[model samples]
Target: MIPEESRFESDPEELVELPPTLPDGWEIATPDAGDRFTVARLTHLLRAHESAGRGWAGAGVDDVLLEVSEASLRTRENVVVRDPEGEIQAWGSVHDRAGGRMLFVHVVARDLDERLGRACSDVLVEWAVGQARAVGAARGLETQQIDTGAFADDERQHRWLAAQGFTMVRTWWQMSRPVAPEESELVPDPAEWDGRDVTFRLVRRTGDGMPEEQDLREVHEVLESAFTDHFNSHEETFEEFLHRLRLEPGHRWHHWWLAELTDGPEPQPVGALIGEVSPSSNGPDSSYVSYIGVLESARGRGVAKGLLHTIIADAAARGRDSVGLEVDADSPTGASELYLGLGWETRYVTQSWHRDVPVVEAD
Candidate 1:
């Protein structure tokens, strides 16, 4: 068995004289069949290092594991680190979507200090840069929401990320509320639609992977059309959307809803909401709204509020204590207001750190 001591060292000041390289006995294996071995080893060590990892409070190693697992399934060439004894200890992956490539990294478990962690992260960043270069991307991007409380639990992670040249480029807020019997008061009256011809519907898939292709297509179209003007809105292709969702451990076909224009002979969906349930290491249970969108024409019809309610109800039905979602504090659409009006209070502020790795200049 690989010794845990070597992987959980707390030396934040490990000298950085030599540039970071792959750990001993670790090899950068090709993509196609890397998941089985890498995921098993990484998951085991990460759970073992639960409280020992730097970012324990916010964005726990478990959270990062979920993020990386989903990312690996969406992105290609997922690079993983293995010990001399063949146990995986760290990893990161990249997904090319929305006209750009996104870099995702997470430590399985490490015996290193702040400076050393930064050095180790650099290896992954460099690899991402190279991958972006190979893909002809104009710039490379990475995202981390500071409000996730990751910084609060592990100041070293924030310091190290900033030291590595990432800059704050966006911000969001996490909000939530208890499911009360009178929660409907927070929403516009469905009865108010008596004069209007529009109707709303809660949509779900048949099974885990058996989503209605047409509904998925409609939701994607609605999302693309709706969020085009929103901050950091990127047009994710259907393939990319499917790939990302498939990566999610708790992704369910029933975890979506679509709103339609009722006047049409065939209901024309114009809005959508996507969410997922995640296992919590700290508490009983929780769910999160990953994405929510409504077409420009569908915005004022109470569709957004209705969809939120549907998602909350779904969470409650699943025995989850609370539902969580992030929204831009200054959204042009005033989304945070909608969330707040519905009794969801700000739990934490999330700042987005970004870096532009411009394409290499041609010789």
Candidate 2:
């Protein structure tokens, strides 16, 4: 039998110095895939954490399990604080998303004693910092960036993150638009929408049900160039881009789309949209606009609206409840106006927090 103490993680001795010491009967241990009780506790903790922050629970068991699953253990790790009886009271997860970007998740049980809750928060944040250092050093980076988020109304989360050296970096507007069954007829099948010489349609697929390499490459190129001027824009290689997107539970091949300028002698791919299926346990599933971009040259045209219409129609055809997306609340383009004109409404708002810390040099 694997000892619970060492079951989930093997901390890097060089990066992690002086282990955490918790007060009360709380104990620190990483989560293990084989432990059913720990997994249940983690799911509960995630749900409770979101509910406390936004007035309703969003993440379910499957979503929590996906992040900590055996397959995902390669680039992600999770730690939790357990009571004397082994029930989890706090949780944290770290993902080495890129060379210097480490995605972090921190959650403390909302119902615990106030004093103990703060203690748990401290330990979790400290662990996250150590993990950042370990990840950065391994990547040969001089500094590592820890990126985390919280609901707009989550003051407790804000306070904890601020106390630990994290600063609010950005605010995002989460918006959703209802999809009606009748809307399916608006775009019709083969959804090749066109306006002002711009064309929007799904990415081509080969007979083997795999996407054509050229089309996929075009999609990536279009998005990369389109977002060059956007906030916090970071260059991602094609390999890294596909690897991360494919890992998402919502990723779907048929949902990929492209916008093209056909007035030229040859079709020029100038925009792309990657849609995913957002599963719902208690209601009809929704379609999420994971990444949507239109080249600056094609902005004045209706490329973006056409891409959105295709997704909305596709969602309607699939019997989805709504279409959802997140946008930069303070975007220079004032893109929120366009979304609002198209019937999208803010459902909730979220904030991104970031901490840049020095990495310990690897031996």
**C-alpha TM-scores of all predictions:** 0.72, 0.91
**Model 2 TM-score?**
0.91
lDDT of 1 by residue, 1-363 (tens): 112121111121221122444444444433323366555565555554444533243333344455444344334445554456755555655555445434444443557555545655666555555555544333232332111123223445566557666665666776877764354443344222211455544454566646678878888888889888986666677876776666666676667777777777877787788887767767646777888998887778877887787777666656677888988877888888899898789765556555555556456
Question: Which 10 residues in a row give candidate 2 its minimum summed lDDT?
Answer: 1-10
| Top-lDDT candidate index | 2
Worst 10 residues of 1 by lDDT: 1-10
RMSD of 1: 8.3
Separately for all candidates shown, the number of backbone clashes (residues 3 or more apart, or on different chains) is: 7, 0
How much is 318 displaced in model 2, in angstroms? Answer: 1.2
lDDT of each: 0.58, 0.82
